[model samples]
Target: MFKADLPGLKEEVTVEIQEDDRVLQISGERNFEEENNDTWHRVERSSGRFTRRFRLLENAKMDEVKASMENGILTVTVPKVE
Candidate 1:
């Protein structure tokens, strides 16, 4: 389950697959949006870059991997090589 509090992060996210080494890399960054009004409040959300790397198996099809995000949920599909 790929869920992030970052709004409008679809364009900044990236998914890369290295077929030679069978390594998959997923990365993205979430920035803080400045609010017009500043009031005394508590901020628990943190802004930074996030990355994930996964090693694929020999039967995995790197070219057929698909990713989609909806309602802050990201789903990745990996097809096996036939």
Candidate 2:
């Protein structure tokens, strides 16, 4: 199980498992939106593409992997084969 903090994002995230290798991949892109007549005194937010990969153990069941996002958090669950 893995959890990541991803705020201000919806339907912009993806999770996948590589078939050739037992690797789990999480990727997403954040774009900056400039509103009309918007003045910024300070800029602190970030925008870019991010990709994270992790090697799964032999006992991990890739077919049973699940992912969900809620309240700026992304959760990925990988079940182990018994």
Q: What's the lDDT for all of these models?
A: 0.75, 0.90
Model 2 per-residue lDDT tens digits across residues 25-71 = 99999998666665765556788899999999999988899999999
TM-score for candidate 2:
0.89
**Model 2, position 76: C-alpha lDDT score:** 98
TM-scores for the candidates: 0.78, 0.89
Write out the backbone clash pairs for model 1: none
Per-residue lDDT for 1-82 in model 1, tens only? 2233445678878888888888878889888756777684665666788998888889887778888877666777778867
> Global lDDT for candidate 1?
0.75
Give the poorly placed runs of model 2, Cα more than 4 Å off: 38-40
- For model 2 the local lDDT of residue 4 reads 91
